[model samples]
Target: MHFLIIGGGFVGTALACELLKQAPAGSSITLANSGGPLGKGLAYGTQSPLHLLNVPAARMSWTDEQPDDFVNWLAGQGNTCDGAAFVPRQRYGDYLAVRLREHIAARPDVHWQQLQNRIDSLTPEAGRWIAQCAHGPALTADRVLLALGNFAPACPHPSLQALPADRYVGDPWQPDALSGLPADAPVALIGTGLTMLDLLISLQAMGHHGPVLAISRRGLLPKPHRENELPPPQWQAPAGWLAAGSLRSQLREVRQAIGRAQANGQDWRDVWVALRPRTTALWHRLDERARAQFLRHLLPFWDVHRHRAAPQALAVLRAAQAQGRVQAAAGRLLGARVDADGLVALQWRARGGQDTQEFKAARVFNCTGPSTRLAEGRRGLFGHLLHDGRLRPCPLGLGLEVGAGYALADAEGREQPGLFYVGPMLRSQHWEATAVPELRAHAKAAARAALGC
Candidate 1:
């Protein structure tokens, strides 16, 4: 059997390792990725020590049977990282690469190879999938996995288009995005999410003591993980909660569950931790309207609580805010234009006020998060797949729809043969799909399914 995995990031690389480990005799595994490194995707590619994994080392193991693989790896050598402590993401990237190399060496019977090219399209022929590469010849595979990760950030607001290249940085992940900024110059970040925190950390790492302003509609910062977590409560979700099909009922029940837990000397986070296993099932139960309501009304609250920051990382940010070096405001950006003083004049309206306000900064970085509309557009692989009627956008417009076993669901609601996907974009089907714990499961399942048991 032959398998092709596209998108060489964490999911892709992990899937390749899983395929190699579980492949039957005389199988071939090909990983196609034009991205920089094998396992260091955007999340782990950061060189900043301040960019730490949100989850603890113990929860980040990629292998199913070895949940302590990551923390144990950290224990090897003179390193003594605590299993419960959140560590640098760069270390996790190192872990992924090291594991991949080790797995490849251990699986000498499997014909393993990497194609350093972006797969442009997948066409099925004679029970095999032919992947067309950007700058290479087409390769046929018995199975193809789309591990396409996050795309470029969507424009935060319409006014962002007015900013000139010299004054604006669209993608914070760019190697030179933070370059050339004055140490003490005012810097405006367009979002108050985790990426904005990353920018702040990167700036601090570079000895930048600039006055940083992060603007968002609600100006919400990610909540920090508790210094000490209570044990996972044995409380069970109420009957019919997962099948309620009403967002209001589920929301109310979740809040009540957290309150009851708190009353019993447990933390609210314990409720969330306990609910992790059922999140996907609950998402499946909710209809389109309920899902939309959750996105429109509850997403922000869920994000701050569910996707929290490491305590150490948040402490630095809180200190910066207390020192007046960093500030966050609830405002809507009207647009930006180059002013007469050669600075970027960021025009915006405060959350509740009608009058427009202006703030001039030497540089601006867009950290509003990745674009979700690319799947609907006609530009790249997503578009080509949709145009070919092989892809269907989810009703919430968040990501592509996947059928059973992570198979690509066509526009006609049929599963595409020999094709599978396991990535953050699975958010459409599994609402809590982006993090390492969730994605790692999907990667292993998809790999095993592709191998036909």
Candidate 2:
């Protein structure tokens, strides 16, 4: 048997390791990624020490079955690291590569290949799947897994749309995106998520000292990790809150759930963890209207609580704010234009009131998170799949809608043969799929299911 894993991000890499471990000798595994590495997807590819893991090292294990694998690996050398502390993401990427190399070395009979190519399309032939890559010959495998991770969110502003090459930083992951800017240039970051923190640290490291403006819908920044003993959440979701309920009821239930979790000595992260396995089921349970309502009303609150930052990063952010180097505001983009001083002038309205404001900066970085519109993703493979009726977009217009077991369903609600999807792409189906703990679980289950056990 042969398995072809696509994407090569955390989920895909994790799936490859698990599949290789369980497969019998002579089974073949190939990882196809546009990015030329075994690990270090866009999120972890940076070498910045300032970019730290949001979750503590102790809780960020790649596998639930082996809790200490990561920490133990970090412990092997005379080099010392605080095991429980969040480490640099570059180190994590190196660790993933080391593990992959070790697994390949141990399993001599397992054929492993890393294809540095973007799979353009997938077609079924003779009970197998054929993957066409950008600059390589087609790969034939018995099973194909779409691990293609998040695509950067599309630029939302029209002025941004018209800016020439050096005017805006559209993609945050590209290393050279901001390389040419002056050291002290003012930068406007589009969102206030972890990526914003990353850019902030990078800019500071590069000696850029100009003011940083971060704009978002809520203008609300990510809350810092509570120090000392973490307090419990203050909301408890009501019964039947996520099922067969109106949007208002669902919102009330979520607030209640947060309260309950806090009272029970758990943080809101606990409620997020609790909702993981049931996310797909709940999403499927919701009709189109309810799903749309959830997206419209609850997504912002869910995201801020869900994708949090490390305490260390939070401290830095607080310091920046105190020093008046960083300013955050909540609003939607109204318009933008290049000003006489060679800066991008942006107009936006604050969240609650009708008051509109303007800001100008030497550079504007689009950090609004990954693009979720399925059709516009333009990765070719996904677009082709959707265009050919092999996959359907969720009602909320997230990624390709998937069913239980991470199965890709067709327009007619039929499962695609020998094809599966896991990770953030399943967000429309599983609201909690993007994070580490949930992705790890999904990878394990998906790998097992791929084996036909």
Candidate 3:
């Protein structure tokens, strides 16, 4: 089998490596990615040393069997860190790139090829997939894996169109997004999530002395992980909670479970850590209505607890807040425009009030997080696929709808033969799919399925 994996981020790289590791002698693999160096993707492409990983070093191995590979590699780099330390995110990106290169070098028996080009479109012909690239010859493979990771964050407001790029930043990950930004200019950020945390830290490292205002609907921020993570506990969700069926009922049970754990002298985080293995199963148990209810009402609270920050990372923001250099407001953005004072003026309303509130800043950024909508504006490859009836989007607009064994299903609910996916977008089917532990397993499974193993 010739496997064609698009998007050489973590998943694509990992999947290709796994294929080389296990596939038959005749099997070959090809990876095509237009993004930065293969394996960096959006998450790990950061050059900032301050951007520490949220997951500890011990749990970030590329393969399950060699669990200590990453820690051992770190030691070789002259960095001494225990299992619990959150190392720089770039190191992991470097690890992935090196691992992919090393695996390819070791497996001369199987053909390994790479195309550092953007995939323009994909089509099926003669029971195989053909991928057209932006600037290369079309390639063919027996299997295709849509490892397209997270897309760029969607613009928060439609009202502010055609503004100066430097004044209004749409995507925070762009290398030049913060370039030319003034050191003491007031700034406004749209979301108070993980992205915002990274931005705050980045700004501080750049010697930005400006006051920053972050706006989110509920003003919710990710809770910081405990200084020393609690050891995993042997625990399980009660049978009653699983059978609760209703979102509200299950949420109540979860709250009660945490309360009970706290009362029993167990950290609430222990209960959360225990639930990591079961979140997907629990998500599947909910009907569409219940899932929608969870998205609308409980998602923010869930996010705060589920996606946490490194304590040291959060400390920077806290220090800024104490110095009155940072503030978070629970509000909704109504509009934005450049004012006479050469600043961006933002109008918003508090979470539960009718009165409008205005905040002005010299620079404004939309850190509203990645757009869950797989196809926005119907302009890109995903949108093109959707328009062609080759893609089925989840009803909740979270991501593409996939089928058994991670096959990509079309709008008509027909699974595309030999097409698979492994990435953050798996969140459409598995609520807890975005992190490392889940993705590594998915990559392995996708490799197996692609190879007909």
Model 1 error, position 212 (Å): 1.4
lDDT of 2 by residue, 1-453 (tens): 989999877887789888878888999999988885777887678878888877666566778988777777777744355545777887777777787787778888999888888888888899999888898589999988888887776887867978766778889878787878998787789998877888888887788878888998887677655443133444444555576565677567667887877788767766665564567777767777887887887777767776677788888778889999998888888887889998888888888869888888777889888876776646488788887789887656687776666678988888887899987877776666777778888899999889876
TM-score, every prediction: 0.95, 0.91, 0.97
Candidate 1 similarity to native, TM-score: 0.95
Off by more than 4 A, model 2: 78-83, 228-247, 254-284, 377-379
Ranking by TM-score: 3, 1, 2
Q: What does candidate 1's lDDT look like per residue over 1-453, in tens digits?
A: 999998888898889889988998799889888878888988898888779998888888877779989988888844677777888999999899899999999998989998888778888899998888889588999999999887788877666666777678888899999778889989999998888888888898888997888999888899988764424555666776546547787788888898897788767787787678888888888788888888898887888888888898888889899999998999998888788999988988989999998888999899888766545455767777888989878767678888778889999889987999899888988877789878888998898888888
Which structure is stronger by lDDT: 1 or 3? 3
Most accurate candidate by TM-score: 3
Error of 2 at 71 (Å): 1.7
Worst ten-residue run, lDDT, model 1? 228-237
**Regions more than 4 Å wrong, model 3:** 234-241
Clashes of 3: 0
Question: How high is the CA lDDT of each candidate model?
Answer: 0.84, 0.79, 0.85
